[model samples]
Target: MKIRTIVFLTLFTCGSLALLVGSWLQVIPFTLTEDLGFITGALSVWLTVVENIWNFPIGIANDIFFFVLFWQAGLFADMGLQVLYVLLGLQGWYLWLHGGKNKTSLRVSNISPLELLVLVLITGIATTSLTFYLQTLQDSAPFWDALTTVLSLVAQYMLNKKFVENWYGWILADLIYIPLYIYERLYLTGVVYVTFLVMCLFGIRAWLQSRRAYA
Candidate 1:
């Protein structure tokens, strides 16, 4: 890592820790777990935008925190999604290290049109089924929750495969998530999603540059 990158990560981590402490002390209106999740989630996304492999471990931590937080909030689909994220995070870690041609480091690539069509169909069907299941459980925001959950899974898969289109999926998911989290009264988490939305734009630009470099 470069010196500037180390300095930035250190500063960001410290600032996040301060927010977590403030939440714990009741100085902030957010829960401790939500704050922790926000910190790890934000860092993970930022690192991902920079194409860093370290995002996987940090994202796994975010997934654990969010699982507990979502469970308490009665977002069953999201809680389940976190579990899948941990598994995906592990796979993404390895792929980022050696999933390219000849087992080299992964490079950003575009998703094929057929793959895009298949993913869209899968997302639609999965969201419908999950929404129905959540409705049976009286889940709040069932349709939106199910939609974001499936979108997130698709985005994570694209990310693991180093597809540049992953940012589009994340951007769509985050747009829905910002309002959904606020409705659930997880204001801090909503804010985190807003941040994720912005970082995803940067991810798109950075990954495109990377792809051009590879070419």
Candidate 2:
């Protein structure tokens, strides 16, 4: 079969399956909108494998959907994180397209020591502050929410640069979030994050291969 035909078939099959599963589970109420996140995640996964810049666009869609879902669930930090994701997506698109010397675009690079240190410090502070504030606000499971919120932000920043380390952050965050989601009775989102965790492991391997090929 032609590659284009194969691609089309794969997308169609995946989308149909996601729709069927979501409907059967009643993950979305009264509409088929809930399946879009799966579709977007699939596209982003494909793009990430290809090291294509288009991942940012699909990432935007994924973030937006999750943002609304989190907001509805009263996960305010996660909800606000999506707003940041939108801005970061834009920044990443531009950086990948233009942030390099000689007017060339940037390429995947390993994390610098200084940057890594800064990220750790920032995440730590952010998590602490958010946890304290959320506890005051009577948020359910504030500590776990704050932890995942900070981890998610760091993971997202790594993704912007196509950093392999992003997957590590995702893996850790998803593991924590899965239990939190379960405790909060967000079964559907728990399932999605579990799926994301698996994908993130694959993503790390995939991006490392891409980085080697690019180098």
Candidate 3:
């Protein structure tokens, strides 16, 4: 079978399943159509398969919808990160389209040593600061919220450069978020991230293969 055929089948299957779950959960307050978040999620996953730059647009849409939901849910950290994601998405689109030193830098590349170190350090300091501050603001589970927020910021920055490390960040955050969403009765979101977890694993493998091709 062609690789294209398999990819389409996988996306279709996942998307259809998410639709079913969304219908059952009725998680969104006023919609019977495909949940915007789930739809964008499936689009983002599909875009990852082709390494398309258009994932940024889908991600932006996903972030907006989620911003509203998270704000209402009082997941303040996640809510704030969704806004950051919009900015990050725009940055990623710009970078992907024109980030090359000579305006041609879209090739698959591994994370550089210096960049990785900086990313880790930034994540640590930002997470610590956000957690401490939010705790003072009486946010529930400030530490966990900060952890997800920091990881997501790191992931978004990496994504702007088309880095595969983005998936690793996403995987960790999704793992933490699945239970949190379930506890909050955000059943559709819980299921969405569960699917996102599986896709992140696939995305890592796919990006690694592309990295090897570049090598």
Candidate 4:
């Protein structure tokens, strides 16, 4: 295998093993709030690792897991986001396999200026709509949650298209999520978002490498 691939696998495997053992042994508390389940919490962190590596299949799995996780956490918007992630993930898998040159597998591609503009517009509209709806329902951190939710939706869509800008969106959302989950008292989940935020930096670098390879 290539050096980068080997390094990624080694780090991913080691980190996952350490985290899993820590959780099983109750080393890191394994939990921060009853707001989230152990498995759900575990998968959330796992999602960050796989996504950073641009692994779409595992992304699909974690997206499904989060669908259940967010639902149980009473995060209806996030639960809905998982549904969209799963749907788009399926499309992403197909595209990655068939959306490439001459109907071969798709390669990493850049977003056009038009798509970037659309992403911004979509973020604005979704955030506004969710903010109003959530406020009416008196949900906790409605604006923050709405903003992160919209950003996450945009990020997931960008990931589906293999757009490098997705990493930036993810970083923004993950930062917001840390405090949002903390407010919900899901401290472990909050920490997981912290990990996600850091991995997003690595993800940006990895995607940039991919872009360079294609360019």
Q: What is the number of backbone collisions in each predicted candidate, taken in the order shown?
A: 0, 0, 0, 0
TM-score of each: 0.95, 0.84, 0.85, 0.79
Specify the highest-TM-score model's number.
1
Which residue pairs does candidate 3 place in steric collision? none
Worst 10 residues of 2 by lDDT: 28-37
Provide the RMSD of all predictions against the true structure, rounded to 1 decimal: 1.4, 3.1, 3.3, 3.8
lDDT of 3 by residue, 129-199 (tens): 99999888777679889999999889878877878888889899999989988887778788889988988
Q: Model 1, range 93-211, lDDT digits (tens) per residue?
A: 99999999899999999999999999999999999999999999999889999999999999999999999999999999999999899989999999999989988998999999999
Local accuracy of candidate 2 as per-residue lDDT tens digits, 90-196:
98888778876775777666888899999999989999999999988777778888998899889878877767788888889999988887786767667677777
How many steric overlaps does candidate 1 have?
0
Cα error, residue 61 of model 1, in Å, equals 0.6
Best by lDDT: 1
Ranking by TM-score: 1, 3, 2, 4
Q: Pick the winner on TM-score between candidates 2 and 3.
A: 3
